[model samples]
Target: MLRFEGKVALVTAGAQGIGEAVARRIAAEGGSVVVTDLQEDRIKALAAELGDALAVRLDVTVRDEVDAAVAAAVERFGRLDVLVNNAGGCIVSTVPEDTSDSEWHRQLDLTLVGAARCIQASLPHLVQTRGNVVTISSVNGLAAFGNLEYAAAKAGQIAMTQNFAARYGGMGVRFNVVAPGTINTPNWDNQPDTLEKFKALYPLGRVGRPEDIAAAVAFLASDDASWITGHTLPVEGGVLTGPGLLDLTPTGPFRKDY
Candidate 1:
């Protein structure tokens, strides 16, 4: 189970939720973690709790912060073995009809471009260590869910991951994407009933948990998936099956009908 015995990983948005789960999982597997999040106190506490971890205050949307986080990872851990792009979330407020260009840019900037920045900063260190990247995308990227701009950016993440895999595979590095379905995280705290309602849409009879995603990410980032790259693994609870009337469209529950 110590798949990351001698490895090191940098996880963005590692304060809580899925990012926290990923950090905990990697640490549990004996990996050194560079836990970066906007919440300084939270990440610092998490780093202390993980024993062999470093906490960094990183705003993925900021290039300087991203670069500094990568540099800090190499400085502390001596090398960077994995980069987990887990900083993105749905931030759009306007409906598709009135969504502004600025909002679109903001969404793409955070979700898509932010990940690219981390990859760019980590590539050199990863090249030396033959490491890899695992981006946390969403099922909306692969299907017709809602969150128009978010979905588009997530889809762009997948496209970029594939391209990077192709471009870097020969250099002893790999790239992959993990598209998750509805997971019970703090992001759903505002709408407690939403997860309950969405559970029926899944064939597994329950929504996903952060641990579910952590398991998938651990596999993809570990040596177990050394031959796997340019791949998008959906960690949904069978929601993608679309059983019966469970159609995820603009009018579906998956959509934020703002």
Candidate 2:
């Protein structure tokens, strides 16, 4: 259970949802976690709950803030073992035509550039520790599931992960991504019915929980995945494989018996 013992992990957007779950998982498994987010109060509360965690206010879009947060983590933990690029979301306008130039820039900046900023800032420390990176991408990035801007940024994360993995492989720094499906989080708080509708899209007959993605992240960041690099593990309850076509036709596709 203590796979991350003596390790220090920094998780961005760790105030809630998937980021919070990842922080909690790492801490629970004996890792020193630095929970970073724009929500100072929630992050501090989470750090308190984790007991050994350090809470840092970080807005990934800001380069200075990202650098400062990484510096603080190293200052507190002595070295950084894992960096989780978890802060990102889609804008309200999912339509490509409806998305303005500013909206496209905003989504790319927050979701893609933001992660790159954190990685650049953490690379020096990661190299020192020969650590790894676990980036939080989405199934939308791998497929056209809507949210065009956000999906573009998520896809960029995968490319970035591969590049980093190749560039830093000699240094013993691995890079990987977790592309999650329809996870039941506060992002769906206002769309409960929509979430219910999405359940049928997944072959598992249910949407994912935060812990589901967190488990994949933990494995990628742990030594158990030491030989793995430049890989993207889809943690989407069979959604990435294919939609549940049979669920749409319960009559068994016009079987003779029927």
Q: How far is each candidate from the true structure, as Cα RMSD in Å?
A: 1.2, 5.5
Q: Candidate 2: deviation at residue 159, Å?
A: 0.6
> lDDT of all the models against the reference?
0.92, 0.89
Q: Where does candidate 1 stray beyond 4 Å?
A: 244-246
> What are the models' TM-scores?
0.97, 0.93
Kindly report which residue stretches of model 2 are placed more than 4 angstroms away from their true locations once superposed.
Answer: 92-94, 245-258
Measured with C-alpha atoms, the lDDT of residue 48 in candidate 1 is 97
- Over 1-258, each residue of candidate 2 has an lDDT whose tens digit, in order, gives 999899999999999899999999999999999999999999999999998899999999999999999999999889999999999987546456777888899999999999999999999999999999999999878976656678899999999999999999999999999999888888779878778877777888998999998999999999999999999999988876755533433223211110
Q: Judged by lDDT, which candidate is best?
A: 1
| Residue 26 error, candidate 2, Å | 0.3
C-alpha lDDT of residue 96 in model 2? 68
Error at 88, model 2, angstroms: 0.5
**Which pairs clash inside model 2?**
none
